[model samples]
Target: MRSVRRTLRTLQGDLARDIALVLLADGIVGVSFGAITVSAGLPVWLPMLLSVLAFAGASQFLFVGIIAAGGNPVAAVLAGLLVNARHVPFGFAVGDVLGRGWRRWAGIHLMIDETVAFALAQREAERRRAAYWACGVGLFVCWNLGVVLGAVAGTVVSDTAALGLDAAFPAVLLALVLPSLRDKTTGAAALVGVAVALVATPVLPAGLPVLLALLALPIAFVLRGRLDEPAHVREEASCPSR
Candidate 1:
């Protein structure tokens, strides 16, 4: 109980405000998801189950959409897996914030884009740890809670789209990462990722393009390293060693 209290105490000020805003947005989207899924004639348990099991908004929505469209269940699962492939890098990036043992495992389960963004946004290790867990646990609760409420009210709100809740997730995500883009390396990486995603979107399946955009990170990093290398070192490397 004290540990939980300590965690909550640390999650104050701007970080707390940011987390609250993000949670509100995600909760609304979660509600939208539940309402839409139920309205599409899926069982009330489906969205709640996916929230706990998958915990990924985009992939879950994709799965529900595909399944609702008469897509094969196997295909829907595969699509969800493909869409979630982006989490591999997220895991790598967020490994530092997650401590050890059960906490690490729980943190991994909560390793969504928003939690990751908040974790990475913080400078100190303690702050990052607090932000990640606070956002993750809060998100898990709010998402599931919202789903429950939406499921109960699903019949009343047959058209979740009319609420414009879908825009909240992406808008909040963009806001979270936009500040980081001011850095040259970060900006270059983002540009490369956007270009890659845009180019691949036409040719690849819905989720594969985003996964392919991860290629941009390495490309940008390599380019940045080359550019930042000393001219003398480059010339020396280009010449034969004695």
Candidate 2:
């Protein structure tokens, strides 16, 4: 009984730690988007709403940027949707571990980059849940707070571009992607996506490059099985010949 109680306490502590860390990271990320929203001439309330409802940081930033740059609303929506379509696969991969019923739905909605990363790092089901919820809720609160601050401060700043806030979007994306490249396929896919986006940027409309980039995701997913097999075989070969 004592051992069980001790284990429970340890788990609770770990959950708390994970939640706190996620909140901090998310808050910082939000500040970048909030600044961009302000610079893009959006109202404070608009960014706050995006932070709360849109929830996906990269998509929100891209949507606001496109709209500010004179892109059509339909284009902005399509671009944002295409950029975020990766969540579909992420949801499927983590579905079983997220459990069932309403909690599963909640998990799906909260399945952002940070939440997925923290969840994947955990070995146990209970730990995964705790970490995921921690990251999600933490990101939600901190991101909103950052948005509020940025919106307010953005008005007073003379030159947002001069401040280099434009770099924030790519920086945040790099943070998410750099950690996930465990194999050649993932690395190659990321490179291809980047190249496609860059090449399409000049030829396509402001928002269409995002859609073009998304065209690569399906290819990556289809090839994932074949890509993993080589790694698996390599690992097996490296094991002791017992």
Candidate 3:
């Protein structure tokens, strides 16, 4: 009881602003996703369900985009899985902080990009757990709420394209990717992903282009290793006698 109280207080004071910012952004994007999904001719309930279940923003957009374009469901699922492959490493990295048993299981469901990043940003174990739960639970609630509202709005409206909501999904996706471009490795990976997707789009099926984009992951890893060698050698040379 006391422990839970302390956690809440700490979250309120320290993480409130950060969580609020995420909620606001996520709410808007979630709304866009819902609106776009409905505009694509899917039932409102579909996006609402996806927001609760799949929860990852980029893959969700891809799934809807593919379906909207008359792509195969299998292809969309495969592409979505490919995009979410990063979560495997994310799980390994934060496995320790997730606690044991049921908590671990539940934590896996809550593990998204923002939650993982916020949790890992903390140095202390306690704070890391707190941040993870705070971001996860907060986002889950806000995102779902936004989805419901957007779906409702989408159902009521006609001609979402004229309203410019058609572009919202891609715009949000670009916003998500822009920050990562600050890192040379990520930027290179993104370029490779984009090139592969663009090239494949002309020849391959709709969702298959996204699958081809997965090639960027290994390319990024190899580039990172090669890029680090020079710095490693320089540091080795600069080291005092050891």
Candidate 4:
């Protein structure tokens, strides 16, 4: 416990504060999601089940949104899978922080965009692990608690859109990734992703453009590899002098 506490303390005040703020915002949104789901005339247990089992905010929202629109449940689930396909790459990127054995499985279950971003933003492994678990576990608890509250309240509570709180998560995410954009490789990748997403938005289905944007990552990796090549080796190859 001491070690865990010490590890957590290594998070600078700013990071800890950021995590706290994001958690608060997410809890509010969770309340909104639950209230909206139940108010749409679905069973109260539906949102509770999704919150506990799916634990995916956007995907869950999309699922409920589709169902409320009279879309088929199977289609809604398939759409949720399509939206969540990004997790494959997320798993690859953040796999190191997951450790091994059952701990790894638990980490996998807790993984999300916010937690992964926090883990990636940290340099040290210990800090990465600490950030991942802290954000993931805290978010799980806060979101479920909010869901329960909203479910019980049912029609009494309104969605957060009335308060314009719906934008908090995206704003926080943009802030989290901006620092990473300072790197040449990441910057190139991000620019390409934005362009791809913009271009594909009108043509492709909702989740597909995000997947298409991920193709930008290979450009970053290739650029990084070329950049990492030895200076002398490059000079020799270029000049090929007597």
- Residues 66-156, candidate 3: write the lDDT tens digits: 8889999998898888778778877888888788888788789998887887777666788888888888888899888887888888744
As for candidate 4, its clashing pairs are none
Q: Write the residue-wise lDDT of candidate 1 on 39-62 in tens digits.
A: 888999999999999999889999
> Candidate 2's C-alpha lDDT?
0.71
87-109 per-residue lDDT for model 2 (tens digits): 87678767776667876776677
Where in model 4 is the C-alpha error above 4 Å?
Answer: 1-3, 155-157, 222-242
lDDT of 4 by residue, 44-145 (tens): 999999999989898999999999999999999998988888899999999998878988888898988899888888888888888888899889999998
Q: Root-mean-square deviation of each candidate, in angstroms?
A: 5.8, 5.5, 5.3, 4.6
Which residues of candidate 1, in runs, are more than 4 Å off? 155-164, 226-242
* Candidate 1 clash pair list: none
TM-score of 2: 0.65
Candidates in descending TM-score order: 4, 1, 3, 2
Indicate the worst ten consecutive residues by lDDT in candidate 1: 155-164
